[model samples]
Target: MRLAHAHSVQQSGAYVRKFGAAALLLALCSSVGVIATSGTPATAAGDATSASRARTDELTLRTGQTLAKVKASIPSGSYAGAYVDPSSGTLRVLVTQQAKAPALDTRADAPLELVKARYSLAYLEQRMGEVFAAREKLNGKNSRIVSVDVDEAANSLQVAVDGPIDAALRGRITRLAPDTPLELVQGNSFAPQRYAGSRVDDFAPWSAGVFIYNKTTGGGCSSGPGVHVGSTKYMVTAAHCATATGQQFYQGHQDVPSVTPELVGTVANRSGYPNLDAMLVNGNTANTVYRSWYNFYTASSAPWESLTGQTVCTGGAYSGERCGLVIGQTNVCSDSLRSCGLTIATGPVNTVAAGEGDSGGPVYITAPGLRYSGIVTGPVNPANSITCLNYPSGLRSCSNAIVFTRIQNILAYFGASLN
Candidate 1:
């Protein structure tokens, strides 16, 4: 018999009774692209202010292709970073050597801009590592460091911390990467969000975007797209949901005596922080995932890489379907202990991207087909708090920004294909 997801509701009174709100959030530790090539140094475009503007709808596809071409033309050693300017719809490339910029003829679709950067991407990444090493020597437990990643636009290393760093400690870190400047920015502590699923309940041949409870860990979160490892079918989710192999998963929330949860699968493999925070649940699974309760979307077999300024949507059990989120940064590392290559997306300040119990849900694009992009890791608290939207009582935590693991990395690490 194929196992499926149980119907989940917005009413949280019962959910809160069974599992405390804070416990669910805390237990959540468990819950959870491509294009062209161009060569030739084209004449550098004017500054960002003078670039032509194109409609976002028209520029999204062209921007992806143009960025690909630019990447292909430049040597990795010379490539600093690149992204689409949200306001201008201009493709911007940062290169250590302006002479190596791709010769892109701007289409009516989108404009292209090339900027000279002081350092190469490789150098920034190396310096980021050095900073992390230096941090370890200076900070032990209770460190204030929140995240560390390359700010491609700034051509510097962004070191996010919750509190101010003393001059002595700052000097020590700065000395480690004397050649690269450090951008010490302030941010709130990021918390991993967990939960999502539609059709509150369903049977074997389970689809993605469903509520899942890890029986071993007693934690609940959402299921990601299904995947295939050899002949075995497995469901993908956040590794924090169940840390070890052989852990059992259920399709429904933990119920009282009147109800029984369905056994969905067992942990076949898992990867955690400092790596892709994902896991494979061996089960009778399908490639289908929910966009809405009654609407099912096909999960693209090919995982697409993320790009900044791209508009994407998220599917979570609690939040259902939320769109209009823009990719803010790619190749981000959350805190000193987490893996790099993570992406951060943000919506309007007052809007909610994904709420509690939304972790491990599908982050995707629906154009052409449902293209898989990534999975929700959690929310990054903004310096200024955003209004939380209405959700289940215990799951009201929301944010304009979220951190996610890129699907390409998750699949590559597992050597599996989206089912």
Candidate 2:
């Protein structure tokens, strides 16, 4: 189950629901052959426009390869920080202990720069864990936290509390990790959404934008990318979209009129928070697939191994297709303080990306030919409200933001493959 997704969705009437996602198709790049070659400094800044564009292009092409090689070669706890900086058209690396950072010989041939940070990456992650634990103490009314964002840019672990942070709670967070940056903001928490699926006997076209269902619970959700484990077909979706596995899988919705859907697959498996919120719908020859994949989302196609400043576009039934930028990563936890998981952060896209019943849609990059990426995870509200940004909007852009799960982790977890 190579994870590829896009979209923002909420399952109506469900308590522990899953986040929506994008379903991007994996398209290979021709220049992939040179991903290993170190980038030459851009020519004298003539085409401030052309020169900048060239740098960005180079950054996108090499970020993934460079990051992968860095992650693979670095020691456990040595990976201080790494990000794709669109502004500089370079990959930046932050080291807590400069002497312990990876040797230049280990870096791939990408446009990269290195710096030093006050804290080690591992320590910050550990502090974030403590902050999540502290958030569990807050009652939903006074200081409920919706999400915890990892802001490497600010070198802080941001906590998005649903409301204002009281004095006592503030002190606790401050005391937990005195040196750690634990910033808080306000926003409404998520709720369940309606408009999703059920199974049918006839053979209906199982394409993107259709509904999906879990037979046991009879709940409805949208379909994402049409994938296959070898020749076996599957519908990649959020694990929470369905309640139980080993049950029958259906399409479209019996509640929504105007048409019918087919019995395309079965609830093969699922995993909730703490792990990736995704599942595989095992379909067979009986399933009819149409334009079941991404449309012209990117200029071409690419993989999901890069991040930070990279762009992520998504598609859903209600919102259609749209593109957004990769901002950062986010972590979400439940009341019991158990179901904790991290997701790829994006959005406030300039297009309608996700909508009601659009869970498990599709997401990719649009410029380099709809390069496939990962699935939609959830939404986040910036720690600040002065800026009316972060809402999914039109091509002109508006306030919006989105979160998704990386396909690299998805494929590695499910042991699946894609082009």
Best candidate, lDDT:
1
Q: Against the correct fold, how does model 2 do in TM-score? A: 0.45
Q: What's the CA RMSD for each of the models?
A: 20.9, 20.2
Tell me the RMSD of model 2 versus the true structure. Answer: 20.2
Residue-wise lDDT of candidate 1 within 1-419, one digit each (tens)? 00111223423432222212211111112101211112111112121112121221133336555766777887667888876565665678898875554666555224777799899988887887667656557542454654566778888887766566667656766777787778876644432222243345745678777778777556567888888878888888876565467999887665433335689889877643324466788899876777777556555564666678987888876677788899976655443213334577888877878765677788887642366788877665423324443333332555667777778667655667887
Query: Which parts of model 2 are misplaced by more than 4 Å?
Result: 1-12, 15-205, 271-274, 284-302, 330-346, 349-353, 381-399
> Whole-model lDDT, candidate 1?
0.61
Clashes of 1: 25
Please provide, for model 2 over 1-419, each residue's C-alpha lDDT reduced to its tens digit, 9 standing for 90 to 100.
Answer: 11111122322334112221212211222333211111111112221244333332343335655665667655556666666564554677765655432344333356667666677677777877667666666444566655554556566766666567787766777777788877776644422112232122223335444455555555455555555566666777666565556777676555445555457677785643224555777764211111222321111112434456666666544345555556453222211111123234455544344443445655555321233466654333211111222212312111245545555445544555542
Provide the TM-score for each candidate, comma-separated.
Answer: 0.54, 0.45
**How accurate locally is residue 130 in candidate 2, as Cα lDDT from 0 to 100?**
69
Give lDDT per model, in order: 0.61, 0.47
